[model samples]
Target: MASKGKISIIGSGLIGRNWAMLFASVGYNISLFDIDESRIDDALVDIKQQLNSLESKNLLRGSLNAEQQFSLIDKCISMEECLRNSIYCQECVFEKLELKVQVFQQIDKYVDDKTVLASSTSCLLPSSFSANLNHKSQVIVAHPVNPAYYIPLVELVPAPWTDEKVVARTRELMTEIGQKSVTLKKEIEGFLVNRVQYSILNECYRLIAGDYVSVEDIDSVMCDGLGLRYAFMGPWETAHLNANGMKEYFEKYSKGIYDVSKTFGEIPKMEGATADHIANELTSRIPLEKLNERRKWREERLIAITQLKKTLDKH
Candidate 1:
């Protein structure tokens, strides 16, 4: 018999499988549910292959071997069975507001008062799709970064009616599964990560639109410069450590920052010729046909960096 504290992951796509594997790594029974049986079957196969690959690379989480962790995941044929006695249900449906509404509504019908109903939405706010649910207090968004197997950051944003305990439990569970989780004080569209990400992207777009930089050079600025320091620390820490301290740092560069900030002006529209030029330049370096292959290559570097961080922290 499976544990009543099982984690139910709805949808067997990349996000869903990643969630299932993360929970299973720490001995949680994972019930994977999907509308398409064939997709579910494919997810299971992909998951096993991923686990084996992680094991060979000495990257598998927890004390358990790949087989032991893989054994903890089960494919569920029905939503009712999947939700039955589950302590948490993470909905990983396609990104559509209407689809999220339908999924949360149906899930609300089958969950207990204690079950945490969370969404894997990247952009939608909780109230947008879950306001009318019977278990509104239990609904929240636990958005994970893509390539979750390599990245550990997850943002937990709660609805206005969400119970405080729900936020606490979600954070605790994420921590237990080796993920770095942050909970928002309230819901916000796109949450925290994407907001900062877009701020950077907006600047990149402006640079390209004004012919100040090429697409490739902008990427190099991130990959070879900002990202190098950002891997281990954030902007705040970077500033604090760069000078004597925060106060001295501000005194020294505050005017320079203000002057540079003025030039940013308004965000670029990024339509028509600007968009076409950027797209063409990117496609030249990484053709659309080889996106998946590139993603794998990117994840491999991320994994190596993750390992390096772990080793450095021990000293």
Candidate 2:
């Protein structure tokens, strides 16, 4: 397959590896790098295994087979080598603000003005680390959910100085690789996903602390109920469908919703006995030693959902 372009992956961790695979599967040449060169080798092995496993299950992305996609990714011994001739650079380094700032500063020195510099940060705003960079206008955040390859949603959050063209090109690239992209008009702390996620977490913690619900029951409220609809539609769309329309839905239930909201307790600190209780309950159900096994189980389910979505969309 012809190469789309070169994509530089600045970290060899899970997110970086997944990014490399997603780009490589779509015919982009990938330069995978990490400070620890040995980790790069390990990541390549894991990527190979993952691609082959996906291929065996008939869930491999893009037209390229596992071997072909694996061949497009090469290990880089230095940051400059990885960034050289790349059209886009994705920084997946540790989430610490200081570390991210240093990495971007170093990347700014090597990348040309045209390269789209994106970070895979889940929460930290793009401006926080990219503000002091020489190429701040080229920086943006392209946060993806865990198991990015299967989840497919990429949040595109731009810094204030980020060029409009950079954001457009990044979204275009994301589309080209078969990922869904949502753009934020302005930078916000925690972006979109985490803010909504933390809101739910706050209520869950409050309920547990008040002894109003068990940890398992709270999880079931999501996985067994809300999650069923959420997998295909968001909250607003779900509400719209529940009644004749969004207007009617709010008119019918808005007062009751407002009344319940007023009665909800303040956010509970996620520590002390409540944390211990939740942790103990979860650990008993899925022991620490079996976490990796459970993660694979989760991935399998995500892949199934991904396949289902594809089939449903085609119909």
Candidate 3:
């Protein structure tokens, strides 16, 4: 399904490199550009290693070998070259606002009017960077998480001035390239996923600081209990299924939920003993020395999970 147009990735950092692999593995021609050529140089090596890693895990598509898979990436010396025949460009540079503004300005000049310019920013909104560009209507945020080669959720956030058709096209392109995209009806801070995550994190922190639960118990509560159900069903879906349906579920639990919510207060500022406790607890489990190795393990596990999901979908 990835027989779409070329994908040009700007910035050769972790996000850009992963985007290159994701677009390439699914059969899109990938072009990468960076001011620091060494970053691109290093990225090619990392991508090759990643491809081999996926192949070792039996996760690569189209029965392609590592060498054949690596052939889809083209490292362009300049932005113009990368944008020459591209239909979409994903900018994954630093998260700074001014840097994104400058990068988008240059990319706007090179790509045609129809080409979509998507930002990989985690926080900065599209309107923050793309507002000054001539092709602002064609620009939007296509934020993907780290290790995008494995995790495919992309948030497609559009600015107020962004064209609706452009958003539709971006969503279509993401789908064709094997990405799962969720559209935001209107722009909001942090979009959907992070806001939900932060809200949970805030509650967890409050509970721990209030001495209601131990740090280890808090982590285990999700990993052992909630995470299992969350893996297959969302919160609302689980709630509905727990009862007869959505209406019945709400009818029985609305007052209980209201009372529980009333007891919950705003999260405390995490700057003192609470933060230190979390740091000590997490570090004891995952030491700073093994951080890089642990990250690789997490990526490998995500790859396996993604492969399992693909197999399940086939059935």
Candidate 4:
């Protein structure tokens, strides 16, 4: 496919490689840059293999074929070259606050006013890193799920000083590339997804700690019970569909829900015997050696569900 414009992806790790492929599949020229030379080389190889695999399975995204998408990615030797003339750049570096600050400092120096400086951060607030940058107005957070190719939801967040136009442009770019994007009204720690995720984890931990449920049962509670309904609709929509509507549903279940929530009590520390027991159970089922295989298995299921949802929506 012909290029639309240039996008630079810093730190060519897993997230970076997925971002590169997603952008390239939609005809964007991608500069995949990493400070470590070998890492960049390895990313390129993995990206090629992934794209080719997707193509062979007829699951490749956008209008571009595997070879075309692979051709669009350029490995950069220097930050200067990667930042030059790019319309947007996503920093996919390590999640440490100090490391992000330093990387953004470097990116801020290189990028021009027109370029959008977005971070792929999961937990850190944008104000923490972009506050000291010269181009703070252009800085925003566009956090994607681990595998950007299948999981399309991206949380778009802007620092207080970030330009409104930058946020809009980031959303536009994400949509154009076929990713679902939502913008947070204001900044907060852990963003949207992680906050929801951690809430679930906390409860799960509490249950296990209290001896009310096993780790595997908690997993089944999600995968077999809640996960089935949540796959297509959110809790609110599911409530709407399950009952008459919001008002009637809330009237019927609010008291029961509130009562159950009150029973949750204090949060567990998630340490000591409970943590060790949970770890052992998980590791026994998914050993360290097969973790990667399990992760890949999970990603394949995500892709399948994504495809299923798309097909159903069309009908």
TM-scores of all predicted structures: 0.96, 0.97, 0.94, 0.96
Judged by TM-score, which candidate is best? 2
For candidate 3, which ten residues in a row score worst on lDDT?
A: 60-69
Residue-by-residue lDDT tens digits, candidate 4, 226-286: 9999988888999998899989999999999999999887867878999999999999989
Candidate 2 is scored at a TM of: 0.97
Each candidate's number of clashing pairs is 0, 0, 0, 0
Against the reference, the lDDT scores of all candidates come to 0.93, 0.94, 0.86, 0.92
lDDT of 2 by residue, 199-231 (tens): 999999999998999999999999999999999
Q: Which stretches of candidate 4 lie over 4 Å from their true place?
A: none
Task: List model 3 lDDT by residue over 162-267, tens digit each.
Answer: 9998899999987866888999987898988889888889989999888899889998999899988887778999998999999999999999999998887986
- Which residues of candidate 1, in runs, are more than 4 Å off? 1-4
Residue pairs clashing, model 2: none
Q: Looking at model 4, report the run of 10 residues with the lowest lDDT sum.
A: 263-272
Sort by lDDT, best first.
2, 1, 4, 3
lDDT of 1 by residue, 192-277 (tens): 99999989989999889889989999999999999999999999999999999999999999999999999997977778998999
- As for TM-score, the candidate ahead, 3 or 4, is 4
